[model samples]
Each structure stands twice: as C-alpha cells, then as structure tokens.
Target chain A: MRIVIAEDAAVIRDGLSLLLTTRGHQVAAAVGDATALCAAVAEYGPDVAVVDVRMPPTHTDEGLRAAIRLRRDHPGLGVLVFSQHIETRYAAQLLAEGSHGVGYLLKDRVSEVGDFLNTLVRIAAGETVLDPEVVTQIMGASRRTEALRTLTARERAVLAMMAEGRSNSAIATALSLSYGSVEKHVTQIFTKLGLPPSQSDHRRVLAVLRYLES
Target chain B: MSFRVLLAAPARKRAWYELGYALVSLPIAAVGLIYLLVMLLTAATAATFVGVPMLAAGVLGARALGAVDRGVARALLGVEVPVPPPFRPRPGLIGWLGSALGDGAGWRAAAYRLGKPPVAVLASGTAASLWGSGLVLLSCPIWWRIPALAHLPVNTWPRALLAGTAGAVLLLLAPWTVRAALLPDRLLVRALLGPTRASARIHELETTRAQAVDDSATALRRIERDLHDGTQARLVALAMSLSMLKDELAETGRDDRLDQARVLVDLAHRNAREALVELRDLVRGIHPAVLDEGLETALATLAATSSLPVDLQVDLPRRPSAAVETIAYFCTAELLANAARHGGARQAGIELRTRNRLLRLRVRDDGAGGAAMGLGTGLRGLADRVRVVDGTLKISSPPGGPTVVTVELPLHP
Candidate 1:
C-alpha cells in the first residue's frame, strides 16, 4: 500500500518512512508541511496518509486542518492523524466526518510498530479504530458514568489492554495471568460494564466501552 | 498609505498600544486639565473682585460643576478620572459654608461649569457630524457596487457615481478633520483635569509607592498562603495516612508484615523534605539566598554560573524592601541567563545604586540585542512583578548587540 507522511521533524519523518518502507508499504511522498503534504497526496494518490497534527508554518493545528480539508476535498482518502498532545477536538471532528477512513492516535502508539501499522491498515480498509486513550480522555472529559471510578485497577488495566486491540492470549501473557483467568476477567468486565455477551472482538470492545461511557 | 505597517509593528512592540495610552494620551490630558484650572482660577478672581454675592454663587456653582465636567470628560476620552479631590473645610455647617465660599478651585471649577452648555452643544454636533459622516463615507467601497450619485436632481448612475466619489473624498479627510474637532475638547479637558508634568510625575511616583507598599503586604500574605496550602496541606494528608498505617498495624499486630508502615515512614520523611524545600522556595520567592547575602553577593553567584562573564556593582547600602530586592535579583539573573543562552553575550554587567530616594538596578549584555522576550510570560511576568512592587522596568534590546534592562523602585518612606 502507498502512504504519504507529513511531519516537520526530519529525523522522525525519516524514521517513519524507513519503518513503513521496511514493512512492505511504499512511502509515496514525505514532506515537512501541511500544504506540501496535501499537494503530494493529490499527486501520489496514496492508499493511506499518516500526518503529524503539528507541521510547519504555524506549528499548531495546520496539519489537522489539512487533514480535515483533505477529507472534505477527497472523501475516499484514508487519513490517520498522530498528535503529541491529546487534542481530541480534531479527532472527534474527523471521526464525525465519516466513521470510516479516519483514525487518530497518540504519537507514542507508533512505537508499538506492528499494532500501530495494524491500525493504519484498518483505517485504510475503512474500519473504525479510535485510540483507546483518546476514547478514555473524551469519556472522562465529558464526565460520563462512574464506571471508570468503580472499576478495579486490574479491570481498568484489562480494559485498556483490550482497547489497544490486544488478543485475550496476548493480554494473558502481558499481565502474567493464566489464559483461563484472563477469560474470566474479560467475562466479569463485560458483565460489570453491563455489556451483553459477544464473541466478536470489535463488537465486544465497543459494547464494553458503550457501557462504561454511558 | 498602508495602515498595515501601523498595524504590523512586529509582535514584541505590540506593547506600543499600552505605551501610547500611558505616555502619550494620559500626560497630554493631565497638562490640559492644569491649563483649564489656571484659566478658571484667573476668571474666579476677576469675578470675586466684581461682587461679593456673585463670588459666593460662582464659587458654589463651580464646585458642583467642575466635578460634573470630570465625569463627562472621563466617559468621552476613556481616561479614568480619579474621584474628585476632596472639598475644602472640615465637617460643620459654618466651616463648610466658609470653605465652600472660599475654595478658589471651586470658583475656577464654576467657570468651566458655566462654559459647559456651549461646549456640550459644539461637542455633540461635531462628534455626530464627524463620526457619522466618517462611517458613511468610509463605507463607500462596500456599497459602491450599486454605483451612482444620489444627491442629484434625478437619481441615476452618474449621480450615484458622483455621490460615491464625494463620500470617498470625505472619508479620506475624516481622520485629520475629526482629530481637529476632538482637539479642542481634548485641550479643554487637559486644562481642567489632572496636574502639571512634574506634579503628575510626583503623583505617579506616589501612586507607585502605594502600590509597592501594597505589593509588600501581598508578598507576605502570599508566603503565608503558600506555607498553609502547599507544605502544610501535604503534611496534614501525610499525618492522616500515618494514623491509618498505625490503625492497620494495631489490627494486624504484625510489625514484620507492616510494609505499609515503612511506606508511611518514607512518605513522612518525603513530606518533611517537601515542606522544607517548599519553605526554601518561599524564601527564594521573598529573596534568593544569594540576594539575601546582599545584591552584589547574589549577582556574583549568578555571574559565576552563567555562560557570560558578568561584572557586578552594588553601591546601595540599604535594601529597598524584600519584595524590591527579590525582583531585582531575579530580573538581573534572568537577563544574564538570557544573555548567555540566547544573546551569545560574551560579557554582561550589572549596576545597582540607591540615589534620590530611588533604587535602580541596570543590567546590560554585550551580545545580540534581539533577545525578544516578546509576549513570553517569563519577561512579562517579571515586568508585572516590577509593576506590583510599584517600580518601573524598562527593556531595550533592539536588534544587533547590547541588551539593557533597567528596574527602578522608589525609596519613598
């Protein structure tokens, strides 16, 4: 798949291009500004575009604005915005534009290379993959139910892992818990969160989130 | 003429707005007020020598009226007219009557009162004609799409064109012409209100002194608040947590298993350190230890560590309140830091002196002068610190080399 990257920092851009290229994806274009990124995307016709929320010429929301403009101008284009700060307003706006073809994630998540790439691929494939941190921040900001407050530290940990799209087996390994125990914790989380039983990974996570948020 | 140049004064000098208001408009108004006052006093004497009853009536009328004029002037000019100066004579019918009759300012004030009717009519008429016409004329470009001259015997495109052209001409002349109309009112106001430049300076200094004293009091309160809120509050929470650990230990009767007690002890020690550190910070906020040793001692420590070589001089024997000393120390330290880090100044120098009842601290760096703190809060915060202490801090770091910062605090008793 072809990808265009717009990031002001030369080192970070080089690293990202190197990382993506090594992952069997083509870096169609790489640039340091929103305007150039938009032009490059139009020229290269990339399948997915990864943009830093802060790019040059007013190192503020220029890149996010370019993202929104791209989405408006080219509705078919897939976009994933990475921000140093958890500024969810842009993320919410992009998601609200269309649930598909868009994803917003913290810059740190990219360090978890394989998982981050999976998110990019999901978004490019027109699947919704909201950053769990962003979702939690938004839910907290909006002052939803006391589900977060009532959650045991361990349960919250388990939920965070699930939100990261970790498999139950992966979560068991990470948490140093038996697979049986992880399964039980997942069941308790769903029941405590008031989510109806579901086997589909995406639906189960969404249901648990909807319960916690509401 | 591009008005954009007038607008784009660079980001740093956006403070030109504040400077224009303070240095230009205020002093001009103050001088004008003094002028009117002198004229009124002269007019009062001429009235008094003419008739005794007339003198009493004129005095009574002037006192009541000068006050009214100040309010009117304050509203129109957007200058804070101070509360009217106190009426003379003590609280008694006889004294009040005599002071009311004898007050020369009242008589002069009355003359201005007398002049008000004609002045108001002129002011109202001119303001309306100028502003209304200016707005209408300046708006021509927006409405010129329906192009025509309207003030013709018949409405037509040619007439609309003529009208629009006239409007453009009128709008072009509006600024100078309006300034002219306002010039008299501005002049009249300046003559009646405030005081002489020297007296105004004295008054400004006096007010600054009052602010300094208030700042000193506020500093004390803030220290007290910090101690109570930060260090004290943390200790309170720690005490409660320690008691909880004690309760848990008592219930368990297992000293060996009391890791929580160890944690609480660690927390208590941590809290103590935190309190001590915060107290030191509070003291630093009051006066840095380097500065506490004295100004020269303080600057020496700063110079020793800074990238640039600093030449320090302290000629003042007595300190100007802890607040003033603190501000001077921090400001000089910051200036030195800035010089070293950003200015690439190889050398920086500071001079401190207390003379003519003012404490002056000047720091200069021989480096790139374009160390624009700009709207950066650190420098502005330093500036505000000076303001709070009833002192003035001037920074002149124009591009090229040699940046200078001067902070002057009054030594008013």
Candidate 2:
C-alpha cells in the first residue's frame, strides 16, 4: 500500500517508516505536524495517511483535525487516526459523516503488528476500522439507550464487533461461531435497532455506530 | 539652624494654595455633614419602606462627596488619593441596599466629611490672622506717620522699627504654619478616601497570585505534552523496534541462539512498555487533557478509571476559572487515589457542585477510616494548593468506618 506518515515524534515517525519499508509498502511521504501532513498528502496523493492525534504546534488533536479536513477535501483518500488514549467524543466526531475510509485506533494496538497492519489494509481498502477500546466506551455509554437494552448479551457482543468494523467471517472466528450464525446476529441487531439493512460492510458499521452513538 | 529653617520654609505659593483649599472646604463640609445626618436619620427609621431607599441614596451620596474631596485635594494640595474599590451589589434590590448600607468606604468618607469642617475652620482662621497681622505690622513705620497712628502707642521710630522686625519674623513663620496645618488634612484624605496601604498590597498580591496559578497550570500542561511527544513516544518506538527484531529473529529459523535473542528482546520490550506506562501516569498526574473539557468530564474520567466502584455526581450551575478548575480537578484526583490506596476503600462517592459562587467537592469513602492529613503530605499538599486561591479543605475520619473530605474553592481567583 502507498502511505503517508504524519507524526511529530522523530523516533516513532522513523520507526514507522522503517517498519513499513521492511514490509515492502511504499511510504510516499513522511512529515511532521498537520500543515506538512496536508501538503504531503496533496503532493504524494498516497493511498492512505497515518496520522497521530496530537502533533506539533498545539499538540492537542491537531492530527485529528487535519485528518477530518483530509477526509473532506480528498474523500477518496483513507485516513487512520491513532492516539495514546481513546476519547469517545473524538470517535463520534470522526465517524460523524459516516464511517467510510476512516479509522480511529489506540496507538497501543500497534503492538499487535499483524492485526494493526490488517486494520490499516482494511481502512485503505475503503473500510471503517475502530479500536476495540472505542467500541467498548461507546457501548458503555449506549447501554442505557432503549434500543440497546433490548439486545441479548450475545447480540450486543456481535453489535460491538460490528461497530468495530469486523466482517461476519471475522466475527465468527472471534466468537467461535459459524458465519451463518454471525450473519443472523447482525441481521437481528439491525432489525432491533431499526436501521435499514445494508449489504455493504462499511455501511453496516456506520449504521451500528450511529445507533450506538445515539 | 535658624537660617536653614528660614530657607527651607514652605513656599509662599503653596501656602496660598493651602489657604484656598481650607476656605473652600468649609461649605462642602457643611453640605456633607447635612447629607450624613439625613442618612443616619433615614437608617434609624429604616423599618419604614421609604427610609430604605433614602438610606441607599445617602450611602451613594457620601461616596460621591468623598470623590469630590479627593479631587479637591489632588487639584490644590497635590495630594493624590487613590479611589477605593466600588461597591459590588448583588442581583436583587435587597442585596444592593444591604451592600450599599454596609459599604466601608462610604462610612469612612462620611466620617472624613464630618470632621473636615472643624479642621477647615481652624486652618482658615489661623491663615487669615497670620497674614493680616504680618502685613499690618510690616508697614508699622509708614502707619505711625499717619494721623490715625499719631495718638496710638506705637508713635516712636524705635518702637515702629521693633514692630517691623517682629512682623518680618511673623511673615517668615506664616508659610510654615500653613503647611503644618494642612499636613493632618492630607493624611486624613489619604486614609479615608483612598484604599489603605494594606488593602492595596493585598490587591497586588491577589493579581500576582492568580497569575502564578495560571502560569503553573500552563507549565504543567507543557510538561505533559513534552513527555507525551518526547519520552513516551520514544519508548513506544523502542518497544516496536524490539518487536520487529523479535519477528526477524524468529523468521530466520536458526534455533541455536534464537531462544536467547528472543528472551533478550522480550525483556527490552517489557521494560519499554513499563516505562511508557509510568510516563503516561506521570503525564496524567501533571495535567489531564480531559480537564480542558471541564471539571465534570475530567472528574468523570477519573472516577471511571478508579479501582473501586465510584459514584460520581456533578451539579454545577456554571464553570469556574481555568486555574480554579485545574486545582479542583487535581484535588479530587489526589483524594480519590488516597482513598483507594491508603483507605482500603471498597466504594467511593464524589459529589461536586457550586453554591454561593464557591465550587465545592466532596469525596467520601467507605473504608477503614483513620486517615489524617498529618499522616501524609498528600493531603497537606492539596490543602496548600487550595489555599493559593483562598480555598479551604476539611477532612473528617474516625477510626472505624467512613471518611469524607471536602474542598471549597472560589469560582475565581
């Protein structure tokens, strides 16, 4: 995959670049801060941009804000926003305009290299991927909603996994269930939450996320 | 000494100015006295509805009189008295009336006004007599030649010369007498009409203390960011590199030295992760970014992350100043940590609200309650931090069961 890296920390930035290069992925551009990230994205037009939530020049959500802008200006470009801590409000905001080609994850998730790379690949392929921590926080907040209260524990788990942008097959593998059973749980969750049934996984994730956030 | 005294005598122009000020003050003082008398009468009859408004108006009038006197002193005597702080009336009519009636500056001004008339009379009388007698006696020789002085006692040249000499002495002393008389008046105006020296110093300290509080908050935030973007980031990178090396070593499929390399990499990774966690905690302790959202959200985050089940309740009508909010948030965080660590708390409750412009936080724990502030520097440090804004901290714990810690802070520094 062609990627652009925007991070203020030199060690993290260089390490990430080296890691991606060793894996045979093209790192088109690497820069620091939001302004340079935007310029690099425009100049390189990479397949995806990996952004840290906090960057130089007001290290509070500069990367998150730049990612949002990138999503708006270059709708086809994928953005994966990573942060040390998961802020539910930032998650809600990032997913506000539907979850296509967007990802929000904890930086700690990078420890699991294979899974993190898979998430990046999924996001670059125009899919939504949210960290499990984000899903848990949103679930904790949405447990009080009437729609969520009606779900069984099993169905709620399926819905949370769905909100994390897991496909039915992946959900089956995680839960040790058949694909058909995972499909049934997804359908039941959509029906219970009064969301329109959709065949697209990205749209399904968005619908589940919107319900949970509501 | 006498020659030096003559040379250092108060300037004639300044003496004239003082005389003018003393003469002009009498009528103003009389009017101020009448106004104060009416105010007092109205206050005495304040049970009647009409007198209440009258009394309020009287207090305002007294303050205005003080302002006029301050202006006069500044313009004539070159004595500058700083204006006192204005009355801060509350929202309702009753609050306004109460504050107005209780205004310290207004009462002081009234007292100054009442006392001014006597001082003015004395000063003006002495000035008039000194100038008049000095002028008459200095022309004694000329007056003795006139027919009016021919039958008077001062008809001889030697006597006339003696009178003239005495007159010269009196003229030299007139300026000094005028200055001496006006010195007490200047002190009175400064004491009554201006903010006292102690209160002025207090105001200055309050401003600087508020700045210090804000500067410390900014500095802590900077430190947290520096650690987040510097040390923590570097540690995470180190862990990732170790992970990559571990992967590379495993992929080579050489079993002889692979196990040793794997163990070393594992140790490095674990240490890096541990360091990252410690740095993360240190950053959070310095200043939580969630606090920028508000005290409620910050406290909620703290409660959510606690080891024990925390019942959190926040009922604030308005947010406090940034410095005050930071202090309150840290106070609660420290207290919660204390409860969980030392108190053996099974469950904790945090309650926050604002009352009478004070932000109040209460942290209670159902624990073995023998906590004393003197037991550790944590509580003492928090108390000192609270005192920066003139806030208070109170703790109550008996040996057996429950502990409750309360903190009260002003909405502003």
Candidate 3:
C-alpha cells in the first residue's frame, strides 16, 4: 500500500515513515504541515493520505480544514484525520462527504496497537473507523436534541454508532448483531427519530449525525 | 391721634410675632440630633439606654418645634421646611431604633447642639454696647415726659443716631452669627449618623472580577500543559516509528519482518492522529468554536452528556465581554462535571440575569443537598476566575443535595 503522511511534528513523521517503509508500504512523502500534506498528496498520489487535525501556522483547525479540502478537491481519495482532541466537527464533515475511508480517533489509540492498526486497515479498505471516545461525545450531543430523544435506548445506541458514520458491518460488529439485523435496527431508528423518511444510507446517517453534532 | 393710638395698642399681639422665628428652628435641630445618636446606639445594641429616651424626645420636640423651624427656615434662609414625616418608630422598638440609625437625623441634631456656644458668645459680646445704646435711644420718646431724664440724655439728632447704630449692629450681626452657630452642630450630625449606606453591589463586582481572572489563567495553563505533555509526545513517537520503519524496510525484504514493520508504521500513523485529537481538545478547552456561533450554540455543545438534567434559564439580550463569556462557559462545564462527579444530585439549574449593571450567572444542583465548596479544586479555580473579572463566586453547599454557585461580573463593555 502507498501512503502519504501529513503531520507537523518531525518525530511522528519520521517514525511513521520508518514504520510504513518496514511494512513494505511505501510512505512516498512525509510532509510537515497540512498545506505541505495536501501538496504531497497531490504530487505523490498515494492510495491513502493520513492528515493531522492541527498543523503549523496558527495551530488551530488548520489540519482539519486541509483534510476537508483535500477530500473535497480530490474525490475518492482516501483520507484519515488524526486529532488529539474530541473533535467530531471536521470528522463529521469528512463522513458527510460520504464515509468512505474516514478515520477519527484519539491519539492514544496508537499505543493500543491492535485498535490503531485495525482502524488504519479499516480506513485503507474504505471503511469509516471512529474512535469510541469521539463516538461517545457525538452520542452525548445527539442524545440531547429533541430529534434524537424519541428513539428508545436500544435504538438510540444503534443510531449513535450509525452517527459515527459506521458501515453496516461495523455497526453490526459494534452492536453485536448480524449485518442484516444492524440494518434493520438502523431503519427503525431513522423512522423513530423522524429523520428523512427516505435516503437511509451511510451518507444519510452521516448527514443526520452532522446535523445533531452542531 | 393715630401715632398715639398705635403706641397705646395692646402689647400681647406684638409680642407673639416678635420672637416666633427664634423659638422654632434651634429647638428642632437639637431634637433631631439627639434622636439620631440614640438610634445609632440602639442599632449597635446599646440603644437600650440611649435610644428609647431620644425617640420619646424626638417625637415630642420635633412636633413642637416643627412650625417654628418652618417659620425660621422661611424667614432666615428663605427655604421652606415642609412638615417632615412624623417621628414614627419602626413597627417595634428595635426596628424603630434601626430605622433611626439608618436615617440621617443625627448630624442635624448635633449641629444645633455644638453650634450655639461660640455663636452666642460673639453675638452677645458685640451687641452688648448696642443694646445699652438701644435703651438710651428708646428712652428718647419718653425723654420729655421724664423731664430731667429725657432732657439730660441727648439731643434729638444724637438719639436718632444712637438708635440707628444699635439696630444696624444687631441686623448686620444676626445673619452671620446665626449661620455660624449651626456650623459645629451640622458637622457633628453629618459625621456621627448621616446615612452610611455602602453599596453591596459594587463590592460584589470587585470580588467577582478578581476571581474570574485567576480562573482563566489557570485553565489556559492547564490546557497548554496538557497539550505540551500529551499530544507532543505522541507526535514525537510517530516520527521515531517512521524512522525505524524506513530503515527496516531497506535492510529486509522478508514478508514477516515487513509485516512487523507495517504494524509499527500503523502505530505511528495512529499516534499522530491521536495527537491531533489531543490538540483539538486543547483548542476546545481554550475557546469552543461553538461560542462563535453564539452562547446558546456553545451550551448545546456542552449538554452532550451531562449526568443529570441541566435546567437552563439564560435570557440575556446582549453579549458580555469575551473574557466573561469564556469564564462563564468554563464555569458551567466545571460545575456540571463537579455535580456529576461528586454531587449525587438528580437535577441541576442554571440562570442568567443582570442586576446593578452586573452580569449575573448562576448554577445550582439538587443532589445530596450538602454541597459545600471545599469539595473540589475545580470550584476553587472557578472562584479565582470570577475574582479575575472582579466578580464573585459564592458556593452554598451545606452538606445537602442542592448546592448553588452564583457568579456576578461587570457587564460594561
């Protein structure tokens, strides 16, 4: 697999390059900030681009903005965002674009090893992998809205993972149900929550998720 | 015939009008001061001996001299003295004394007291010669009747001159002398018991602002520290892993070794991503972007997962200072966390209002009912924050479930 890394910190960039190189996946470019990241992604044309949420000048949401723009500019380009905080705003935006290959999680997930690489693999395979903590904050926000409260506890849980912009398989695995069962639960949740009567899919869930987030 | 008739008229009617002014003003002023001192003592719990009697005196004397003071004020200063509120005691003796202490009748009474001595001495000494001459001049009309006494006293012109001199001296000195007489008494009353109300509202703002500054600084530092130590570390690890993966790939082409290297590379990627999340958390801690949308939107962001229901009552028409709003937001977040973490409360309430040109922000909870402030460092920091704005944070957690923390900040732009 070919990957392009976008992180301002040198240690992380170098370490990620070394790790990828050893894995036989070429890290064609390890760029310093998100601007450099986008340029690198454009030039190298990697299979997946991992960008940090905060980068160089005015270390605010520069990285998040860059990730959003990169995905917007180059459609179908797999992009994963790394954030130190519980920020689902940019992640939701990314998922809203169509939840393919979007990863949002805490940095601590890296030390967990299995979860971190699993999320990475999932992202590479074009699946949305969201951090549990990030999902918790999202669920916390959605639960407060009138639109979300109408769902029962069980249905609400299903909606929460869906709002994470998860795939049907991911939702099933998360809720410990079959893929078909998860799909059924999601439909019931959408109906109960009074979301759009039609257009129930990953994008719709992401749309509703983003709506409840703000 | 007319002159002789006027001279013969009854003296009683003339006498009543002559001394009317003098009898009124001085007496009333004296009574007011005495009443004021007594009331002060009573409020301090010393009025048992002083206040009761003064109240009695003020009631009787103030009424008696009321008309007189009016006549004097009108005659001397041309200022009318309406019949003031009657010397009514509070519903009870204690309340009455408190009211007296609170009102400003003390200095007026004292002025009438101390202001008389020097005034009398000067006026009397200066007018003694004039009065003596007055006796001589007044005798002129009777001089011829007295025969020897009238004829020997002086010529008509001299008598006329003497009368003029006497009256002139009295008239010139009277105005100044009377005004001087009340100076000491007025000063005494003003300083002793004049209204001494200090504004509680102003004092409260000062205390609250001071606390607010402290809390903002502490919060900012905590966030910076969290970022410096937390996410910075992960990014560094990511860099190191990238370095290792590059070197391992160059040395070995085996599938298993490459797979192990792949794992490390993935770890670095995840580490870097997590670092970004930490950085975002730090950003939110500093200023939640939702605040830019508005305070309501920001609050919506906060309610994501509060343990108990947060009843909000914020009805502000205008926005407060950025510092104040930020402090308020953090204060709410901290309080909710506190309630959830410590307060076994079932519900909480938040209210916003303005009073005395202050932004009033309050948060309360219905928990174990015994919520005291010493419970957490978070509140201490909050207290410090409100202080920074020269505002105040009062925590009422009396070992029960319902604990309330109220903050007040200056609303001035």
Candidate lDDT scores, in order, read 0.63, 0.83, 0.61
TM-score of chain B of 2: 0.64
Candidate 1 Cα deviation (angstroms), residue A76: 6.3
Model with the higher TM-score, candidate 1 or 3: 3
Q: By TM-score, is 1 or 2 better?
A: 2
TM-score (C-alpha) between model 1 and the true structure: 0.38
Best by TM-score: 2
Model 1: residues >4 Å from true position, as ranges?
Answer: A56-58, A69-77, A111-122, A125-132, A142-145, A164-170, A178-183, A196-214, B1-413
Instruction: Give per-residue CA lDDT, model 3, range B1-413, as digits (tens).
Output: 46544433323342223223333434444555565455455546544686465655553443343345444545544443333333434445676656654433433434444454443344344334433454555555545345565555454766656655665555434434444444443343334322223423444554575556656645665666466445665554754455444544656766986878777776666666555566656666676655644565566556545646677777788877667777788888888778777877667787888754578878888876555556553777888877766678987777655788888777642
Model 2 clash pairs?
Answer: none
C-alpha-based local distance difference test score of model 3:
0.61
Error of 3 at B71 (Å): 46
How good is chain A of candidate 3, measured by TM-score? Answer: 0.78
Relative to the true structure, candidate 3 has a C-alpha RMSD (angstroms) of 14.2
What's the TM for model 2? 0.76
Error of 1 at A64 (Å): 2.4
CAPRI rating of model 2:
acceptable
Best by lDDT: 2
lDDT of 2 at B229: 76
